[model samples]
Target chain A: MRESDKDIIRSLKIFSDVDERLFETLVTAAYAQRFPAQVDLIHEGESADFLYIVLEGCVELFASSHGRETSMAIVSPVSTFVLAATVKDAPYLMSARTVDPSKLLLIPSQNVRDVFDQDPAFARAIVTELATCYRSVVKSMKNLKLRTAIERVGNYILRLHDKSGKADIVELPFGKRNLASILGMTPENLSRAFGALQSHGILMDGARIEIIDRAALETVSKPNPLIDDFRS
Target chain B: MRESDKDIIRSLKIFSDVDERLFETLVTAAYAQRFPAQVDLIHEGESADFLYIVLEGCVELFASSHGRETSMAIVSPVSTFVLAATVKDAPYLMSARTVDPSKLLLIPSQNVRDVFDQDPAFARAIVTELATCYRSVVKSMKNLKLRTAIERVGNYILRLHDKSGKADIVELPFGKRNLASILGMTPENLSRAFGALQSHGILMDGARIEIIDRAALETVSKPNPLIDDFRS
Candidate 1:
């Protein structure tokens, strides 16, 4: 195994406590590849043949119905995608594509299942990882079903601001178009939602966002830790 | 162990392959209780102490934001809620309440974790269970984000119809108000969505629904199996 690849695998919290022997088996079966920007890594409904770990660059996980695609999540470097589908050997529910030229490690689904069965530590880690992923999606559902588009935008900015350690101005990580879909809104609606937040003390200049009146925004946004806090 | 409790535990696909001794440990720690209709079993943000398994009746799992609550899911008999939270000892993301008088088995979180660590069979079962749950929520997110409210209503009805076998007429399992919240809409909007579906050949009388024109509803719904199929 490549030293760099081994390092990446070791870095993931899921593999942190696994036996070195089992980890060696995992690393032996895994192979890394690079993809250009906007390349579809996996399509919805395709048999989940492999679990892709983003080694570098971002991947957008989205689902489409009636030709309209809504972004579900953005998997960043050093994280895995479609783990549940891969574990169960089920068809992918969401399509994944790179936002920029990316390097990813692909491990066969069968290997994942086999390793999971052989190593109790690996299995335990998978339980924790899958549980976290499940709760995260549940949080997303609550965010979608409980809040309006503008509220979503407001809380999202607040979360970013919080993550940046109280930076008054925070830059959007991805493009507005993708963020709109991630927030479950149309591009036009996203524009209008940002306009609505302006009344709540936000000033958007290109990718940079300035929270002019945090107090006022909090009144409108009502960011709850259960819904807004990602780290938990 | 009660014969009934052991029977229920054995029936769950998650526990089907586990050793009988471990199943006895689970059953010993589990205690069943009955609740009146509209009882709140667990609230969001509370530390998850126990995992609740529904033996009978239904539970509505919902989240509240800024004083407005939206139902996230309806858990029926033989299923579990807040499993991820219980497994990780994390705060519940969604509050669970009985939609009707319900019977539930409560298993201490610590016991669950202990058994999980000691029994590889149990750990594997949890892996499969958690993976199934993660995929289920992903499917829900896709339903909420990728489809409109009316389309959600349409597909939901289609799903209920599908679950009921070839029956053209189906009765809603819960009240319309709760169903409205579950579908992420105001009661009025739900009514409007139902009215909109009337044009697509759906007839609703109280809780009973008849799909007069399956093809028309399917066309309007555009129910792709990737987004709408529940059994997969």
Candidate 2:
């Protein structure tokens, strides 16, 4: 393995406590690949071959039913996606596609399972990672089921502001259309939702958003830490 | 361990391949309890202490945000809930309540973690269980996001029909209001959704449902295996 790749592997939380020999075996079988924007990385119902960790750029996980699609998540760098499928030796549950020119490290799923069987620490780490992902998805479901589209928009903006270190203006990570899908609304509904939130003091201009009255918007959004705060 | 409890444990797919020693250890650390209907079994935000396995009756997993509550899933007998939190030693993301008089086996989270660390077979079992759960949640999220409320209601009825051996009439597992909450809708909205679906040839009376035209309702629901089928 390249020294830089080794450094990246060593830095991952999933690999941190793994024994040196198992880590070396895992890293040896892993390879990094670059994909252009809109490349389909994995498809739902396809055989699970590799566990993917994003090294750069972003990937969008989505699901489609009867030609209608809904975005599930926007996976960012330094994190893994699809570990559940890899560990279970099951088919991928969601389709993944690159949102930009992205770099991804792909570890053979067989090696992952083998290492998990041979190393207790790696098994524990897998449990931790899967649990976190599971909980995050639960929270996402809560956000969808408990909140209205307008409230979801409000919370999404508030989350972005907090994520960007409480900036008065937060730049969207993706386009408004993609944001609409991720937030579980039509682009038209997203536009209307933003307009509706203007009454609570939110202003949006293309990708830049300004929270004129955080308190009022918070009232409208009702962003509970249990549901909205990923870190907590 | 009681013979009955051992039989129950042996029947679980998650515990099927577990080592005998580890299984004995797990059963020794486990105890079953019964709760009356409408009783809260586990609350959100509380530290997870036990892994719950439903032995008889039904449990409802739900989340509350602000003042509103959303029913997440109807966990039936012979299944487990909150495994993710127990595995990771994290707080419960959703509160669990009994929908009927229910029997549950409570295994100390520490014992689960210990056995998981010591027994490779148990660890593998956990991976399979967690992965199945993670995929199930992913599918649930897809259902919530990719389908409208009426479509959700329609598809839910269709799923129940399939589950009940494709009977023309299917029994409701729980009350209509609870089913409404589970599908992310108001009871009023559920009524309206049912009314909307009458055109698609669905009929509901109390807890009894009849699909007058399965093909017509199926077209409206668009049940995709990727999003709706749990076994897929």
Candidate 3:
């Protein structure tokens, strides 16, 4: 890996408190690779071999059952995916694929466990990261169980709007089919949800959504912090 | 706490690796209490103050939004709940309530963090626990998003049957209403799902389910280990 790439990995919260020598050892043991768009990164039920860090582009973590598949989460740049599986030395619960041409750092799971055993700081960081990941999934499960498809879509838009500094126009990060799957809706239902939202405050032009009335959207979405706040 | 209770807590996988002196500090900081059935232990959005260990009976971990409620999980005896929230010093994402008269141990969250920082063994245990928890939720999300209500109900029954040593008769651990919510279905739909399953070689007597033909039940359920295997 490039020195610049090593610097970026070192700066991540999970590695920020690590001893410099150990951090170098970790980076030295890892390798970086780039993949084209829509390339499969890992498959569910396979033993987690490497802990993946997305350095560029996007990755979608998804799972399938009985021939039906659904998107679980989208991993953006400068973060890790499947760390839990890597930590537990367990099978990957979800499959991951690139949404666009992506670069990733692959650290051997054994190396990670070895470092974690030797470094108290890294172990603490792992606990924090895993806790955050666990809570995020709990929130997602609550959203799925407690909200309707339209409500889920509306709140998802609100989240994007907030992430974009409350912009008037926000672009969908991925395709509608993927979004529908992420929000636990069918493509047709997602289209109808967008149609239903038009009467509230938003105007959808293909993937670009114009938030004409933020208040109206919030009222309809009823975004709860427990469910929608990613940072908390 | 009784000596027997302390022994039980020490025997838990999360506590098994801790230094004996530090383990004593943890138990010394914790206190046990008994609560009546239907008691609410923690509320969503409240800062996590204690790491709760269920000593007796059952606790239901649930969440609500927009006046709609759903059951997320059921914690039975001799296990911890909300460890992630406690570790992160974050708000509880789900409310927990006692399903029956119960006994519990409440360890101050600060104590957990302090011990976690000082003890490498404890930290490693926390990682394993949190990783297992994170994977469990991911599996649940897959189940919810990828399967129909009928499929979920059937698969849930299969899991129960497996847990009961493949007994011909398996009883639901909790109420049907709780089961319905946990399975992400309305009571009406759950009833219909059970009704639909009769043709698949199962008979329901109140909460007691008799799997008259295990093969037929498995055929309809199509139980995937990725979704149904708790140990995995």
Best by DockQ: 3
TM-score of chain A of 2: 0.97
Q: Across residues B46-124, which tens digit of lDDT does each residue of candidate 1 receive?
A: 9999988898999999888788888888998777788899888899998989999998989888888888887777787
Model 3: which residue pairs collide? none
In model 2, which residue pairs have backbone atoms overlapping below 3 Å?
Answer: none
Candidate 1 vs candidate 3, TM-score winner? 3
| Tens-digit lDDT track of model 3 for B144-176 | 888888889999998888889999899998889
The DockQ values of the predictions, listed in order, are 0.80, 0.74, 0.86
Candidate 3 chain B lowest-lDDT run of ten: B126-135
lDDT of 2 by residue, A1-232 (tens): 5788789778888899999988989999999888999999989889889999999999999988877888999999877899998987878889999998999999999999999999999999988888888888888899888888998999998898899888888898988888999888899999999888988978888778898999999988988888888773
What 10-residue stretch in candidate 1 chain A is worst by lDDT?
A1-10
Instruction: For candidate 1, report its TM-score.
Output: 0.96
Model 1 lDDT tens row, A1-232: 5797788778788888888888888888888888999998889989999988888899999888887888999988767889999877889999999998899999888888888888878887888878878878888888887788888999999998898998889999999999998998888999988888988888989889998899888888889899888865
Quote the lDDT for A200 in model 1.
Answer: 88
lDDT of 3 at B224: 92
Which candidate order results from sorting by DockQ in descending order? 3, 1, 2
The DockQ value obtained for model 1 is 0.80
Where does candidate 1 stray beyond 4 Å?
none
Q: Is candidate 1 or candidate 3 better by lDDT?
A: 3
